[model samples]
Every structure is written in structure tokens, then in C-alpha cells.
Target: MSQAPDPTIHTLSEFLLHAGTNFQFFDLGRGVHPLDTQLFLDLENGLRPCPRPRQQHAWFAIVFWSEGQKPNHYIWFVKFPIDERGLLVAAARNHFLQIIVDALGQSLGEEKHDTLPDNPYSFVPTQSQMALFSAVTKSCLSLPFNDGVKEVEHYVNAPAISDWRKLSVQSIADFAQTLRDETTCHTVAQNMALYHEDFTRILLESAEAVSLPTAFKQHCAQYCADTFSSSPALALAALRALSSEQADTISQTLLNTLLDSKHADIHVLSVIAGRHYGQLSGHRLIQFFERAAALDEDESMEGKLFAGFFSDLVQLPCLRAEVLGVLRSTERSEVLARAFGHLFSQTQKK
Candidate 1:
């Protein structure tokens, strides 16, 4: 008798081939995009870097369709960290694959039932995140929107219903996906301020994954600016949800607002650094660096803010280069100089 495949293949594609007959992969890191298994394998072998690198980690989902009576598809949500080189860390992926191998044994393709225990390798996304993933997945797979979409629209359109809690996050996600439609975009823009904060946040969070119409983006920018004046927390949440293009103007507005505040909060600055770094214009970013330099002299929370911003900025080559240039050309204070030097040293050691 012929021996079965080893079932211990390290790469995702090979593991899937051994485990199931049909499968689909989706990337959930920065946005939702269909990923080819071959490309993923290439990433594993260090033949190529991850297609889109973000936040030093990647989120992905795998749909395994093993022929069975009770359940046909098993969905796995996984997050793996990337190395400094932007390639998948072999150890992280290997750990996840080992979990699957241990659970199912070698006969992975011939499973009789589809059931999974509490898996350590799997992660549960927040309601807003899950909504974004679902909407993107459906669009990528050419599947229909979920049944709850219409209900969400009804709740948002109805001023009579005072309770925003009635609307589900999924419905908001589906509605966001339709924002690509000009009519839907206009309608959402017009009714945006009327919605409750909770509802607006859901919509904004979901909007991050897809491009919004320009008119609608303008509305979001306005909302973010207004909210920042009233509540920086809500404003930051909305700001993070914006697409790169949309974030540019919104970020400028938020930065100006935050700087004008009596005492700038470190948390707010940290959020902007972590989420909206790329959205910032070069001029604005240099202004931020100057502010950091000044703050460093004061020796307050400058270290915390600089660390957060540096961590994110250093990951991008262009941004990293900008920081290096600033370190070289500008006459930074002693505190700022040491901070930048330490970051560079740590990165090289890594």
C-alpha cells in the first residue's frame, strides 16, 4: 500500500493540501484581500516578503472545505508576527500548523466530521473588526451580503427608533460595503450626524477596509474634526478607521485641534502615531518631530510618545529614512538625540 503524505508540511499551502480538498485564504491585516496559497508559501520560504506589511503582524483566515455531512467548511482566524525582514516568521507559523497536526493526526483529508475544539492558534476579532472582515470576504468571494444588511439600513434611516443599540454591527458593515455606490454614499453622508455615537463609530470602523466616495469622506473628516473638539476618544476612533487618502486631511485637522488643547494628552498622540502615521503629511510629521524634540527637553511623557511613534514609523522604509534624515540634519536636543540613536541601535541589533 502506498504511504500517505507526511502531513507535516511546514508551509500553509502544503499543510492545506494534506488536510483538505478545497480551501480559500483571505488576508485581514490592513484590509481584506484574497491571497493565493502559492504566494503564501513563497512568503513562508522567504522567497518573497508579505504582499502588504502592516503593524509588524498579519491577520488571515482560512476556509477549509472537507467533504462531510454535518459541516462543510471550517474557518480559522489566525494572526502571525513577521520578522524584521518583513517575511513570515517560520516559528510562528510552524507553531500553528503543529496544533492542527496534533489535533487531526496524519489522515487530515479524510475527516468524517467537521468539529474543532477551542483552538489556541485562532483569534476572535472584535465586533467592528469581524464586521469589516465579513464584508470584505463577501466582496472578494463574490458572495451576497448577509441577511441583516437591510435591517441595519432600516435602523439607521429611522429617526423614530431612538435606540441605536437595535442595529447590529454586521448590518453597519454591510452598509459600509455599499458606500461604494454613489447613491448610498450620499445618503450616508447626509444622515451621518443624525446617527448616535455608537452607530457612527461602527460605520467608521467598517469604513477603514474599503474606499469611500469623496463626498462621504469629506463628511467623515468633518465629523472627526467636530468630535475631536467635543470628545478626543471618539475622534481618534473615527480617525483610525479612515482610509489612507481620507486620513490625510482628517489627520491635519485632528493634529491642529490636539495641539491647541491646554495640555496635550499622550494617549491621543500615541493613537495618532500608531494608527495615522502614514496619513500625516511630511510637513506635519516634521512639525510633530519638532514638537517631540521640544517635549523631550521638558522630559515629561515625550519618551512614551516618541517610542510609540518611532515603533510604527521605523517599520516603513520611507518613514525610517525620514527619521534618519531628521536625526542627521537637525540639531536635536540631547534627549531627542539619545532616543533616536537608541532606536537605530535596537533595530540593527534585531
Candidate 2:
């Protein structure tokens, strides 16, 4: 009998295209189809051949077979840029998402299931994703998100994860320093909140990343340690991931870090803190809560959010307070409506 084909393979840029591009396999080798071969070939050739098409941007990614127990596995998606104009391409904007969705889909095609897996790929170990995304994201031009650009955005700004490993300590430091700049600060903050992988160690390892201002570094350390602490072990991992010296300071923030916690009681404390700090950093705290709520992805998540926010928000004297009152009740309107009801009531009182 013929032996099965080698299951282990490295699907980097060139090889990924070779294996999955415009093609798919069934049951390890029973069937095949060329879905978009011509398009890929034409695009590849147009971008490469001739005197150079002067493409606006570039991207990269690393795909590998994840081996583990259970029905689920991971497909690591790393994106980065190659040139100065990497940021200018519209495709570079949402490139990470599109690339990840398409790449992972194509990469895992018919391997485990003929249909798409319910939770195909999520931004879990988000550092690898963020590092690559940040690298490409850093260079993307200042432009609004457009539908036309969505398709190519992810693939347009990818980098080999190895490239992130190659980045210099000083470069990482410089990025931390850029955290001072409003632009970079905004970018880093968003990434921290959005794509955090729960493992801050990789981001923190480079002592270079610590070059950020005291406050920025503190923010990042606490944010990472708190946000990724999904389980007891992961929470321990998150705590350990903080800079050794900085861990103590982060512990203090742990009191206020409930904004992102999954636990209900801690969330109540965050609500209290957010009510007081909400107008200033309160919004950020709320953003964290809302993100957690959305990510919780079910009534369970919302139940916790409602209980926490409902209980604590009322103790405060703001518009949020009234909204909580409505949620506490069975009012069948949107939260925004309740928020406005509070606003309108206050207006009439004035």
C-alpha cells in the first residue's frame, strides 16, 4: 500500500500560495479544485513581471499545522510590511483580517471538516497576530475603511513571524517610545485592547518595549496582565508576564483592572471605578467593559455585565446611572434609548 503523504509542511509565503492558492484537497488527496488559480496567477505576475508595476504595498504571513488534542487547533497569522509605503495601500488596512480568514480557511480546507468550523480561528494568542498586524498597521496610510479595500487589506500587510523575531531591541524600544506620539499611542492602545494574545511575555521580553514612558509602559503591562488572565493558570501566567520589577505596581492596578475581568464581583469594582473615572479615562474603562461584554458573546457575558454595571452604575450621578436603572428593569428599548431618556429627563429638570 502507498504511504500517506507527509503531514508536516511549512506553508510560508511562497509555499502557502503553492499549496492552497486557488486549490484545495479532499481527504488528504482524493479530490482537488482550482477555484481562483487564474486570478492568483494573473495578480502575482502583474505585481512581479515587467519593469515593475510599482505596487502600493506589500504583506506577509506564516501558516502551520497545529497539532493538539480535541477538535480545535490554531492557525497563527502574522502580518508585516516591507517598505515605507506599506501603510498607503487601502488593502493594508483590514489586510490582517481578510488574510487570516482566507488563509486559515484555505490552509485548513477539508482537513478536519468539509464545512467551516464554527470557531475557525480567533485572535487568541494575539501577540503573534498583533506583532505582525502592528508592523503592517504602523505603516498603513491614514485613510478611512472602505469596502473595496477590505478584501486585500489582510494579505497586503503581512510579515513573516520570523521577521518580528528579527526586529532589533532598539526598534522595539523606538516603537514603545512612539507610544508617546498620539498616533502611535492610539494604535498601540487599540491593539492592546483588541488583539492582545494573553501572552504579554513576547511583547515584554525585548526590554526594548519598556522604553515607553513610565505611564505608557505601566498601562501596557497592567492591560496585558489583566486582560489575558482568562483562567487561574492563565491569570498566573499573565501576572508572571509583567516585567519583574513592574509586577508590584501592576498588582496595585489589579484593584482597578476589573474593567476587563471575567469575574462578576471584580467587574462591579471596575464599574465603580469607571463611574468615577468614566468621563476622563472612564470611557476607556467602559470601552474595556463593552469589549468584554461583546467578547463574552452570550447572555452569560451580558448577565455578568448587566449585574455589575447595573448595580454599580446607579450609585453614580451621571447619565449612565439612569441607563442602568432602565436595564435593571424590563424596559424593551435599546440601551441608547434609556441613555437618552436619562438625558431628556435631566434636560426637562433643567
Candidate 3:
């Protein structure tokens, strides 16, 4: 009788490779962006921290499939907590791995396991998020486009005849993920003004998850400026759709304009903190906190807005040091200073 193969699967990456599977990792925290395989291995091995954390946790999706088999992929939506310094909590990861080992043992890759054990670490993404994730993953694998892609393409090509309301969000998401040519991007940009508000909102929301072409970004920056005062919601959606990297002069200028607004409301402030926190640095970083602190003080809410956003931003590995520096800065305005004091007082009470 042949001895049972070693049941000791050490890491998720190892388990996948052992199971004769090809896999991809995507960071679902801030956006549905692909995660480098090596970086994920390093994170699992405790060699480094999660680079893109949201709400103090590292949320990611693993899509895997067997080699030389039909393209029926399986996904695991897993989240693990990060320490104050942003390192993965080994205990939580170990617990999850132990559960996997107990459930599947040494036969993990031998057969397709459609479901994982129910656990707190697993979560279901929103419908829009799911659509975006599926679109991105399929695009990465060079798979055939979903049927919705042609409908979206038709709408983009000839919006006069296409019924905008009939376009499914999934098709829009697939188009956003697969769009690459400058001509297609230009067409999308030129047609933006003609799209219904509902269609435009869905398009912008879908665009927020992917890296767009330069032409598209430029047009979006202009669109955002055109509607900044007249249509704040549409403007905000446009801002969210703009690349967080903000590589060009126009994008950077628009972001600066939003941040520098003295009358920035909670919606504007939250969008900056959530979608574009990556743009915060040096003077811009200080400006963001200052603007957040200067919000119209509600007697009932007090410093909750500032404190809540601060707590979230400070937990990010990329922003932690800059956030701490802001906290210790002497150049803060009187309102900002008072907000910090209230934050500290509240923390102590807790």
C-alpha cells in the first residue's frame, strides 16, 4: 500500500502550487487591482506587511484553477488583520490555514473544492464589486469577453440607438477593464456628455476600479471642472474615476482644487480620503487634514469626522508615517489643533 502523501501544507501559495493549480491574487481593499504573486508570498511568510490595507485589514481575492483543465476557476475572498505597524497577524493567518488543512487535508489539489469552510475571514463583495472583479480576472487570463461586452461596446460606439438603461453593470465593468486603445477611450470620453446621468454614474463607478488611458483621464478632469459647481455629485463621481496616481498636470491640478476648497463638504472630504489618499503627501497631506478639521463643527458630532478618517488613513502602511508626522506638526491651524486635542481626549476615555 502507498503511504498517504504528506498532509503538511505550510502556506497558501504552497498549497495552490502543490494542488497543480495556476492562481492569481488581487487586492480588493482600495480597488480591484492585481497583487504581485511574489509580494503575496512575502506577505504570507511574514517577510513584509500588506501594502494596501483598508479599515485595518488586508482584503484580497485568490482565483485559482487546475492546469490543463477547463477554465472553471475557484475564488476565495479572504481578509486578515494587520498589526499597528501593518504586519500581518500571524495568529489569524495560522488559524485560517489550519481550518483549510483540517477540511481538505492532503487532498486539496487532487480534487476541485468548490466551497471553503465558513469563517469570519470570508466576505461577499457588493454586486458592482463582484462584476468588476470578474471582469478584471477574466481580462487578465485572456479569456473570451462576456456577452455583455458587445452590448457595452455597441452603446459606446453608437449611443443614439442603444438604450442606456438596458446596459447591465457587468457589461460596463467588462468594458472598463478591457478598454486599452486610445481610439476607444477617446470615443468613450467624447460620448460622456451624451450619456444619461444614471448611465454616466455607473460608467464612472466602474472606471474607478481600473487604470484608465491618458485621454480618458484628461477628459474626466475637464468634465469634473465643468460640473464642479453645478453638479457636485457627478463631479465627485468624476473625481473618483480619475486615476489616483494623477500622473498628468490636469489630474493633479483638479485634485489640488478639490483639496484646497475651504467649503469642502463631508462627501468631498471622504472621497479624497478613501479613493485618493495616495495623493496625500508633503503639503497636500497637511492640507487634507486641515480641510478635514475645518469642517462645520456639529455640536453633536464634534471631532468624529476628523477622528474617524484619521484612524482609517493612519492604519495604511504607505500613509502611517506621514499621518503621524501630521499629528506631531506644529503648523496645524487652531481648528486642527483643537480637533487633535478632542481626538486624544476621546481616546483616553475609551
Candidate 4:
């Protein structure tokens, strides 16, 4: 007997479009955001690269359903690896869709999960990610009034300290998305001092991957600068928020300040390296490595920071070559040499 090949669809959007369905796409790489379907199509077609590339992988989700079945929409959270240039690995996506077809068949329905096979590509996001995604999805679907939206709008305006527990994570995300308003921006800045550390941490994580408004960006830079001298933890949190928006000016200034110091703070260095390193100028990267190498010893705090930062920067699509160039240069530090050797050894295995 001849076995039949598995049925499959190619791109996710293709599957939805074929059924004349409605859909929402969210990019889950750094944080959740409404991904443009055209950009996704371009990525699948090799006409463009991933817009927000991180570690050469793009994580995203798509929710789709028939017109009357909004509540029953299917959500698929998948992460796909890209090449050095940020293009998707075609075979990987194809294989995933093929497996999905084999397991779940050609149709989507409320009963689909009953027969669906265990999928490697499906993922459960962290609590913060789930909250942010929920916020984005609600906005996209234009569902009935969200209490989170109403509460955030009021909270930013009134500046109250009732209880951090009372505020929803979705509200924080909603507030972050609406920071274009000057009043909201000012209110949030002013109220940061009153916020609990846990609340601040959650908000920072939500804001970390979002695009802040220009006004908010300016206010944030000033606020973080002033606070950095007093509270380094809060400053780093604010920096993480700024980093995702590609806030180069403030981040660059901070990086320079740390590089010029003999005893740099490891926490600050790690945040900058993990979040802002992708957008750093090549000159800054060169200067950074040189300064990092000048640290007292390979086993010191500065050296540990350098290793952590370099390991992260080496994985970014934009910085891979720049990192390699620095690694191969004669001036490379012993600490960096060790990191470089480990990175290549792992790469060779893949």
C-alpha cells in the first residue's frame, strides 16, 4: 500500500485568507504588538526581513476565526528562527504547518483541540507577555468596553496610590500604549516615585518592548538620568523601557558614562547589553569592547559584565559581524576570547 502525503497550508495568513476568515497577528519576539500582515507576507516571501529581530528568532502569534465565531478564534503562538539576515527558515515553517494539518485536519472549529496533536511550536507566554497580548488582542478585536482601558485612563490623570494590586497589568500596557498624550506622560513621570517597586517592575517590562511616544521618550530620559544617581534599579528599569523603542540618545549617553568609569555597575551593563546593544553604533560597540577589555581582570565584576554583554550582542543579527570583527581583532581581551570560543563551539554543533 502507498502512504499518502500529509495535507498542509504554507503561511499562516494564507490559511486564514483561504477560508475568508478574519485574523490578528501579534509579534511576540521582544513583546507583543500588532504585526502587520503585509510585513509577514513579505517575510514569508523573502521580500523583507523580520522587523524586530532578536537573537535571530522572531516569535509571533496569529488569531483567526469565522465572522460569527469571534469567541472561538484559534490562537497559535509560534517562534521561528531566522538566518543572519533575519529571513525566516522556510523549511521550518513549512514543517510546522504540515504537522498541524496532519493533526488537526483542514478545518478550524471549537472541536479542533480535541483532535489536535501536541505541537512543538505552540507556546505559553509569561504572565506579563500574556497580559500585554491580551491588551493588544482586545484592541484589535474592538470588543466591548475594557475596564482596564477606562481605569488606566483615569489612573494616569488622577495620580492615585490606592493599591498596586487594584491595577490590572492590561491597564499598565494600555497606559504605555497611550503615552503620546502630554498630560499622561507627565502624570506617569510624576507618579513613578509613588509607585511600588513591583508595580514599577511590571510596567517597565510591559513598556520595554513597546514604542514610546516622543514626548514620553524625552521625559523618560530626563527622569532616568535624574534617578540613576539615586536609585540604580529604577533607572535600569526605565532604561529597559527606553531600549525597546530604540531610544538611542539617552542609552548612548548612559553607555558612554559607564565605559569611562573603572568600576562599572554590572546590572546597568547587563541591561544595556541585553536590550540596547542591537541598535548601538559600530563605533560605540568598538569603544565598549575596548573599555570592557581594560577591566582589572577576567574574573572581576566588570569582566563578568563584559562576558554577559558580549554573549548577548554576538547573537543579534545586526551586531553579529561587528562582534565577530571585534572578537577576531588582535586587541580582544582574554575574557572576550573565552566567550568567543564558546559561541563558535555552540554554533558549530548547530
Q: Give per-residue lDDT, candidate 1, residue 278.
A: 64
Give per-residue CA lDDT, model 3, range 98-201, as digits (tens): 67766766455545466677987899999978987888888888876678788888888888899888788888888887546688888888888788887777
> How do the residues 1-350 of candidate 4 rate in per-residue lDDT, one tens digit apiece?
22223234467668667656678788776556687889888777777777655556778888877776446667778878787667888877876777766665555665773344677666778877777777567656775434666666555555463556778887787556555456666677778777777677667666765667776776666666777777777777777777753547766776676666643455665566666775566667766765655452444553444555665666665667788788657766565576556556755777
Model 2 Cα displacement at 56 (Å)?
A: 56
Better of 2 and 3 by lDDT: 3
Residue-pair clashes per candidate? 0, 17, 0, 0
**Candidate 3 off by > 4 Å:** 1-8, 109-112, 245-248, 296-300
Candidate 2 is scored at a TM of 0.21
Query: Considering lDDT, where higher is better, how would the candidates rank from best to worst?
Result: 3, 4, 1, 2
Pairs of residues clashing in candidate 4: none
Write down the TM-score of every candidate. Answer: 0.77, 0.21, 0.92, 0.77
lDDT of 4 at 321: 76
Q: Quote the positional error of residue 70 for candidate 1 in Å.
A: 11
Model 1 residue-pair collision total: 0
By lDDT, who's the top model here? 3
